[model samples]
Target: MSTAPLPDLVKTVIVPARPDRAFAVFVEEVGAWWPLAGFSVGGASSSVAFERDPDGRATHLVETLADRGTAVWGAVTRWDPPHALAFTWHPGERADAATRVEVTFTPDGDATAVVLTHSGWEARADGEGARTRYDTGWELVLKPFAEHAGSSR
Candidate 1:
């Protein structure tokens, strides 16, 4: 196989909210909008959240299994509200094999343009295959987030 790096997966969505609100909904209310049943290590009944520090800053993302066990999806590397958030992603895998994901929110008139970029695929053994899956996976994952972000809270 070739040793070339895989291309980054980029997806964007426009939500009917300001940048701040869009960012908040994406991070704070992820458990409600994330399609856990389809895209989780812990099955449908599992819940996911950004675990916070004592000062309320998100430190990592964790998935609480149906059996009360937990799987750490990733650790927060960058957290800038209403603008950007990034982390090392390796759900159901070891941290040493983690890839990177970065999301940015920009104001677009009355809406917010949310952009998600998943990269660092070369770190995984199945980098190309995983990238191919996530190429479409993000669409399924972000649909609910866009809808929920537009809905009244």
Candidate 2:
């Protein structure tokens, strides 16, 4: 018997942009699409940064209302342009217990299909919840990406 759930960690969306453009938005323009209300920093993030090199850092910096508290989120596991991006998602939770998020982009005609797989939650007690969160998160992320891509053309 398998302890894993029915659906694996993969969530895919087809965007109306080439692989490079789609990849750039995820790395460069993430702050524009990231939902401030859902951030783990307990504040609205001022800037989101993603380092492209392997083992690089993907950081989300947010400032609290009191101006006395500032928080940063994320860790990078893999970075491959126009192909895949993988990182750790800790937000407000324990960084060590965070799950891994892998996103891949494959060319599909004039568009690119984005496949996001957030796994490594198999060991967490709240794996089901985490999966549910990502399931919705992908929709949030992809919707704006698609809209933005459509407008650009």
Clashes of each: 0, 0
Evaluate model 2: give its lDDT. Answer: 0.68
Off by over 4 Å in 2: 1-7, 43-46, 51-70
Model 2: weakest 10-residue lDDT segment is 57-66
**Cα TM-score per model:** 0.97, 0.77
Candidate 1's residue-wise lDDT over 21-134, tens digit each? 999998899999999989999889999999999987789999999899999999999989879999999999999999999999999999999999999998898899999999
CA lDDT of 125 in candidate 1? 89
* C-alpha positional error of residue 42 in candidate 2 after TM-score superposition, expressed in Å: 2.8
lDDT of 1 at 145: 98
lDDT for each residue of candidate 2 in 27-114, tens digit (9 for 90 to 100)? 7777666665554365454445554445444443332333455443557667678788877776667666667778898999999999
